[model samples]
Target: MQNSILLTGATGFVGGAILNRLHHEKKHSVVAVIRGDSHLQMQNVPTVRIGTFDSDTQWKENLVGSDVIIHSAARVHVMNDTEANPLAAFRKVNVEGTLNLARQAAASGVRRFIFISSIKVNGEGTTLGTAYNADDAPAPVDPYGISKMEAEQGLRKLAEETTMEVVIIRPVLVYGPGVKANFLSMMRWLNKGIPLPFGAIYNSRSLVALDNLVDLVLTCINHPAAANQTFLVSDGEDLSTTELLSKMANALHKPARLIPVPCWVLQGGAALLGKNGLSQRLCGSLRVDITKTRNLLGWTPPVSVDEALAATALHFQEHQ
Candidate 1:
């Protein structure tokens, strides 16, 4: 049956990819909800402009006739937020805004709600060999993660009280074309043949490609088994920092000029440079075990890491 789908964040990086995927499939009618008129123009997809997520904005009209709602719009993590209360700022959008949308969607007869969360809901990093799984207790250490955890709780409660099915997905670092922030910085540095000091770092991390994440989101849209379940998704292959940089260099067709620096030295230097968090991210282990995601959904990441990296590099080269 052709389903009427409501997709939020249709203009952002990951959301745009999801929108393209759905458009190409041509199996569902999509209504994109954007904050303003600045949205992608598609041939048949209609758009609704909702200014903000406060109480005054009415989402019911948009929710009507929508069988599924993919809630991807959120106030993402601000690395250097100057707000007096960062947690409150995040909760205003990520928590309250999300619940508001879910409530309206439930009331409007939406059958399913898919929420994209972060693996930071688990913690910052993991031990050397251990990987984070779905069963791990949530240990959010930052404002953004706390808000996501709160949103997940609120959605689960709503599901218990209503008929709408909620599926929560916690994905690790997602990378692909159009990716910005630290990932983009790293790619640019690699493209310029900058010698990085992560050659000796031996920490493993799991990451999901944009295409893989979109595939998983589509799976949860109507899959009966995905109802009321929390999933941890990744590329199913883990890599160390050194290995990752090397692979990225290969994809960029450049030499991986890396200098071997002691882990302690790297951490100390980062602290002195006011980038301690960056150091942890570069030299820490954070792996996610996707055994549950695989066994339950019978799904696998369609793109390999090498292929995804190559695509990303090619896009960067062309855009630059």
Candidate 2:
């Protein structure tokens, strides 16, 4: 049976990549829900324009008859959020908006709803050698994460009340072409051969490639075991700050000019500069254990960390 898939965030980074892949594969009929005016011209794929995500917006028309709804759209973390109430702003979209959509989807008889969430839902960072798994209690630390946690709770409740299956995925740092924010900044710095103070930092962090994440999403779209399940996804390989920088440098064909600065010194410097969060990210150990995803779903990340990094570097270079 050809499943009609309703995809939100089709214009954004991860969603765009998934849209392109689905379009290229031609296995399923796709209806992309985008915001505002769209000039996206793609053959065989229909587009729906929803002005904004809120209580008043109607989604039943676009949601009806869809077999699966891949909801990738959410108010992501803003480094310096300017909103008067950041949590309220996030809740409006990530929580309330998500529940609204899920309600519509359930009423419309949509079979599955896949929600893309963040690992911050697990917490900021982890202890060395300790990895977070799907069973870990949610410890959302920020507004964005709190909103996602609320959305997940709402979705699960909706699932219990209705037949629409809800699959929640909390993915660690996702990197690929068209990536932005801190990952993009790191790539640019590596490309320019900037010396970093993370050489001695031995903190392991897990990351998922865009392709790997999309692959998992596609798997969950049809997999029976994925129904009403929550997952933590990563590349299955972990890397330290220095190791990651070195790998990125290799991908960029540049020398890893890293100075060995103690983790304490880095933390102190970042605190002095009012960049404590940034320092934690640079020096913290946050790993994900994908044993459950592997054993339960029978899925694996197809792209290696090296391959993904190289592709990202190449794309960055070409775009530059």
Candidate 3:
């Protein structure tokens, strides 16, 4: 069945992908909430521009008859530091803004609220071989993660109090076309033919393709099994750092320039500079188990990591 959907973060990566998919499928009436003027890609879609997150604007009125609410907006990283009170900034939008909209949604009779949360809510770094599942407790390590974790908690509590069904999806390291930040940085390194010293690092981490994530979001929007559940989703397969770079090279149609460098030596260098913390994230193994998601929702990621990498490479090539 088709329904009107209220979506936030329409200008963002994941949100934009879902919007495109919805348009292509002709599934629903989309009301996009953007902070500013709609991007060229979103200009044709109906939108409500509100500069402030806490504004009790008439946007809620649009949600009166909406079937689902997908909250995707969050203050992503501008840099790698806790320069100011990051938790405060994250809360201003992630926590408070979320509740403000959710409360209004429930009041307006929206049935389901789908939250796009990060896996960082589980923890910052990872343990080798072991992977985090849906049953694990949240132990957010950073300000951003803490804000998301708090939002999840608050939303769950609100769901218990109201008729709104809240579905939380935690995705890890989503990468695809038009991706920026760490993903783009890695692409740059590969494109430039830079020889990486991570050949010996064998750490497996789960990743989700943009298309696969979009598929999951669409399913959660209306699936009966998705109501009031927290699901950890991924591509189902994990990839080592060396294997990932190799796949990337293949996608770019370039030769791998990977060199074997012991993990201990890299850690030693980072320790000297007091940046051992970063080394953990860069070379750490962070895998997610999506068994529960499949069993419950009867869903799986649609794209393989290889296909995702190929698509990303083609996109970058066109842009370049």
Clash pairs, model 1 backbone? none
Clashing pairs in 3: none
lDDT of 2 at 240: 92
C-alpha lDDT of residue 305 in model 2: 97
What is candidate 2's lDDT per residue for 103-140, written digit by digit as tens? Answer: 99999999999999899899999999799989899999
lDDT of 3 by residue, 1-320 (tens): 78889888988999988888887788788888788665637457888777788524445566868888999888875556665788888888888888888888888889999999999899865688799998799989878899899899999999999999999999998899999887888888999999998899888888999999889999998889999999998999898888999999999998889999988888888889888666786688889999999999999788998999999999988998
Give me the runs in candidate 3 sitting further than 4 Å from their true place: 38-40, 55-58, 81-83
Model 2 score (lDDT): 0.92
What candidate 2 gets wrong by more than 4 Å, as runs, is 41-44
The candidate maximizing lDDT is 2
Judging by lDDT, tell me the better candidate of 1 and 3. 1
